[model samples]
Target: MKPLNPGEPRQVGRYRIIAEIGEGGMGRVVLGLAPDGRLVALKQLHAQFAHDPRFRERFRREVATSRLVSGAYTAAVMDADAEAETPWLASVFVTGPSLKEAVDAAGPLPVESVRLLASALAAALTEIHRAGLIHRDLKPSNIILTSDGPRVIDFGIARVAEDAQDLTGTGAIIGSPAFMSPEQAGTGQVTGASDVFALGAILVMAATGRGPFTGPTAPQTLYNVVHGTADLSDVPEEIRRLAEPCLAKDPARRPTPEQILNHLGPVPPGVAPWPPAVHARIRQQDAEVRSVLALPLPVWRPPPKKMAPRTKKILFGSLAAVVLLLVSGIVALGLSIAEYAKPEDPGVASLAVTEAVSPERLRLTDPCKVLAGRFVKESGTLKPESGSLHPARCKYTGLNGVTFNLQLGESVTVSGLERTDRTAEGLPLLRSTISGGCDSVVQLPAERRFGIVVSRSGKEGDPCKSADDMLTAALARLRTHEVDRAGDPASILPLDPCAVADPAVVGKNIANAESAPRTLRICEWQGGGNTLTVELNLGAYVADGSPVDLGNGVTGDLRGAGTTKCTVHWQHRPLPNREAEHVTVMMLGREGSGSSCDPAKEIAASIVPKLPKP
Candidate 1:
């Protein structure tokens, strides 16, 4: 939640608005306090929709039906005013983060947690359908995870079953593409079964952090919903068994809410249904709401002012002089505060850094831009290499046999590092010198650090000095030109390499295999004296090997490296500039292991079919 901005309404009807909760394509939501002191989440429609008389009538009817929905797992709609200038509806406020936020912050849910989530959602659907309403949108963001259990919120898009056709007459899609049912993707009929399909997709996301049929673009995703297969390879076996039937191409084959509840059996009892990190977030939000409620509401009054033109002009001149003096004083005080806030201890200093930068903001940052060619030139006459194996890394090599490597979003340990007085954009810088290289780390939020390493074959010059110079240049560029990943949904830069590959295929290729993520874009499986590494990166595709057909109309370049290693690389799609989004599957085995390319080809074939097409 955030503080209300100027010009925002302080009160709507009988409820006093506290703060803005969030906003979506449809309208804005705010935390409101009822006259009786009950906390509620109130949603107000956009003014454009309120101007339409026919929409107002439909909204009035839908709100009435929504009020009838009363289930343990659903947020009960308390009241609404469809006749108001901007129609608004109030519902019970549930203190928790949305499923999307929880998953993005804390990663995917465990199997037990996922099972509990499924059961609660199924129960909520039963109540909604029973009231003759169908929730057209049931994505992760629409579900809230509380301490007790999950609550399905946001029925704003819901309508009576008989009225769905009328609502869709304009042929506008009504739901999120990743979660839409095959029927909804096309112009087919939508029913409660459509919700069931969305539930299955939600379950897949809860289990794997990615939807079963997600494509890069909305149109591509919709096409996948109608024709492509659901990718459940990353989903756990326990949940996949239940989600499979719900994703059936035929709506008649899908299970009803009651059937789903029966299949899942009873939900086990638990005080905390979410992971500890997620529970911490819930507690933080709860505290914030309490603090906000404790503060007294501000009283508004009109100013009383009457002055002659000459007197007003004289007062304005005096006011401007006083304001200039006050501004000068404030600037001096701010400088003193900044100096006082900089702690000597690195741990305490990191707290201030955390408040300035957030993990969500860092997730979209491009590491390559942080260590650009111009920044590298500041240290020496070094030139950038093609690209690193991961998207969050870059490499530069100089003709003088010097190499510099930079990586972003790393979990670094700074206990033994030497703290320096130098800082990059107010972020503390730590240094360490090793055998032939010097490393510098810039502490960021949540222990995430950025590293700059300078290496040389001989100690001809101070590598530490070079590392420091590059760090200064990188930080300066980050302040002015922090490059971000492409906004294109089809870009593979945001995907997890480990989750993209089929786990079963990896197991088949390497016996008793165990998977571990080396970086955000790299995953490795090792067992039985063999190792397989999968990487998702951005670079120019190397067409140096024979092109072999992979399944799903994709082809990959198969090449061998020496006697023990083989690699299969494929371009998923062309990116901006001369680079392309690509994947690499490399197999490494004992020296005597025969023809690793065969298994590498097989693994690449399995992964190619699951990726989103360009």
Candidate 2:
């Protein structure tokens, strides 16, 4: 979990946001504390989809279906507002790592555990199907392995069974390709059987490291889902017997939840059900829940009870706790919290940014020395470029036309926990964004001057892996004090990318401009059409644009004048001194509606003079 970003609203309806829970393909999910002291998972749709009427209708339906679902094995919707600026839904926060995370971390569940999971899941599906809903996007990630049982969540694409079967009516297909049933793969009639197929696939994934339908791509995976038999090599024999029928290609041949539950028999009461690792994860979640509840608030009283033994015990405990709370005040609450707080991970460093070790000592050392490693050798020839004003930088234009740049400097980024990893040196390394091509930072000490950054510009393979590998090599070389310096080291790092455009200029093009520095060189403003991102020095030229003047010898290329996206780039730095250093301004319109390139050129013109002179 992380603090909310700048644009994210802290209050959604009756919920007060704490931090981000996680993000999915659709949008972000934030952890919110409800007024009644209950914690909730709040999902806010992305602006892209929020503007789509079809998506709004689907979200409306999802809220309705999720509210209808109720059981120990399913997350239920608690509140929602479909008419908000950005539609949102709030559900009870079920605490646990996703089933996928569990399997990935601990490997497959034991045979007995899988059997128990199967029985519980079948019963859950029976309830959902009974309510006339088909969980169209059932996958390992959507299943929460709670202490009591599995709880299904994120019914983002769920629709009533009686609704026509086009899962991707006007939007993209939603379900995991590997877990889809043949009917879903073909976009045909999807019923409860489809969920059964997904369950079978999920179990196979649980038993093995991979899904049953193996493929190199989504289309191929969908093909395998329709044609190939499940790869059940590692599944335990008895569990396989129950899972195989559910994986049958023909939905008609698949066993219903009732039949599967009957075959699996009754689950014994009082069983702790989940594996050790899963239980450990549950404990972590339990701690998080307690921490959320421990926030300062008005003293809450115990609600009327049903007068059972468990209720009496709970009441008695509450009375004692309340007495202690009244007598000891907030100190008692703090003590209660201290007892349940999770132990910190020893491998992770303190988030405090340490003082940066000045690269000034290595000024004479080639900045390219940072690139002296296996990944660099594989990437081909190193080319010197000065288009960007940043000091201590070099670039390599690979054979595939992908350019990789290494900047030895300090930078701030929108790094997420999902993308954070430790270098061999154990420095705090992180990806710039959950979704981005390449950016790695050895976060400097709070008072440090700079951190090492290895960035690649292109749509390529795993950027994080590439970045981490390069960072490792860079740190190892930096230790030797034998640097491979390149380009001019005397120069200071370039002006902040956002500084190139004044707020007034930004406001002129995008309303209510709020600047977010993605990196030292890339800045984004989210207001007009929700977002207008600017990446500086990404490339030299625009493929299709009419050259135009932005005053004082600066020239710009305007592209897509009448189209939905209008972009204008001004080459702020002159040629020969460096590769073209340009600033791009974009206006991302909704759907097929957008402004003319004239506005883009106007914004470009306004900022051209502010940029450093050629």
Candidate 3:
């Protein structure tokens, strides 16, 4: 490969001139912006490689295989026209040093980070295998360590193992020698297991800052990788265990992706469910956003203020970072809260665990909060038509057995009640009102939405003499629920509507709340029939108006325990009778005296009653 003349346009089909990102005996990879404005690393085939019909066929197969493999951990194939003049291909431009560069500049990654990297890459290879393709070339140069996470790049040599007989024609060495699996070198075919073998080699490099199989020449490295054993003596126990399975001499002995995820450990309870891929993407985006934000604003700005090209790049990068941060923050905040919950105090709050009965048999004297942070009282359980009260069915299996699920809309419901129940201190286990389809219910713990089956058969004890004891039990339940629902990353961030009010109005309320500390402004808006939006100015509790760390901002939502005179109407309409009765109770404690507070209920006089009988 030779360098092109300066300012001379080099075209590969529709792709225009761009600087080269990498060059080798096979070809050169040019950096180009796609027609749609996506940065793509375009690999342009050198004349020598392109002229070989065998290589062209292999390259075409690589493009097809790459397109079939779609994963968050892998660099996505954006565009490729293999049949074109120069047979160009493009992938998402990952901006960061390669793994080789990182290791060379900063030394080997920490042990924990290395393990994380191995697990992530192992998981990515699992996807590649699932797609019926093998990344024959898994080398350090092809591994991109971007702000988001490690992305497996360069699928140029990737091929389906099943087609190896037809594609390879005769057994031939095709991939990097040091990372090649024994099967790849011998049979010219790489299976899902082959990637596992390569992953072990990569882990060895990440751990000791050197490849396990090394040689001054490619042939020597190939010889060692084909017959030699990896040195795990230097690898830490924690990571060595992970690498050992991948390094299994017999591919059948290696762990599958599902098995690998299981070995990652039990998922924390009460957090939003996320599969490994989404979970990884979330962390990657979060880190990338934080990194961009940490850069000085002026430093991130374009050199020429109004230059169209530079200005566009700056705007694109900045916008991308901000969006990533906002979304990640919302998700992380929700998951973190569920993951980290302090135990309830012993003196103030107590916990009680009980069996669940049929829909009409269960009972509740106190109000309860469900999945969406919504609250319901005991009276809400009765049906208007029959005037007959229904209970959320709770079953008994030996001892502790109950499953609780609560969804909100017209009324609350429990679905698919299982033999499971968990406890939480200060978490009100109120009554549930059945409405619409999906009739199922179970009680939930604080900072958690899932239920668990307690060990009721054990030594009989409430474990609720004090709030502290109840809290300890509740934390256990939270952790349990998190593991059960491990998938669906969207659940990580529950939707939260912002409180709309003038800053000046909020400022005035803050001043009053600080000085008088007793006066609170409660405003309500009718969200049409069966809905309302209540605004309670907690002043400082709304701190910077951020939804997270909402201190003392518990209004009529769950925390108020049906005591606050604030409620937000969800839908925009008037109630059928232009009225729905509700009450608000406020208590003012002496200075630093929340415990000394007294009850004061403010009931709405003569509001609309329940829906007219059918």
The order of the candidates by TM-score, greatest first, is 1, 2, 3
Query: How does candidate 3 fare on TM-score?
Result: 0.43
Writing each residue's lDDT as its tens digit, candidate 1 over 557-595 gives 888845579989889998666689899999998778787
Winning model by TM-score: 1
Error of 2 at 308 (Å): 47
Q: Report the CA-based lDDT of candidate 3 relative to the real structure.
A: 0.47
Over 4 Å off, model 3:
1-4, 266-614
Which lDDT tens digits does candidate 2 get at residues 1-614? Answer: 66567775567777778878887767789988787778899999876578768778878888777788887788888999886768999998988888899988888888777887888788889888888898888888998888888888888877887763543563234578888888776656788899999989888887776898866444446655765668888887887888899999888999999999899888988888778988998899889767755665333333233357788799999999998867587565564323223322112111122212333333334565445332443344334453544435776554356566677655544334344647546576766643357777765543233556777666566656666776766665565433523222111123455655657767876778798655445677877564566755533444358888888787677788787678877655434544455677776766744565666677777766544334
What are the per-residue Cα lDDT tens digits for candidate 3 across 1-614?
A: 12345765555444543455677545668766554545577887766457669878888988888888878679888878776656778888776666776777667777756756765686688788888887777888888775546789888777887775577556345677677887775553467777778888888888777887775434335545655577677787887888778877678898876677678764344433222433454456446534543443221222223347678799999999999998788787675322233322212111133211111111111011112121112111111121111111121221122112212111222343332242243333332122221222224422123332211112123211221222233333332211122111111011011112322332332233211111111233221111122222111121121121112222221223233232221111222333222222223223332321112111111110111111
TM for every model, in the order presented, reads 0.51, 0.49, 0.43
Estimate the TM-score for candidate 2.
0.49
The candidates, ranked best first by lDDT, are 1, 2, 3
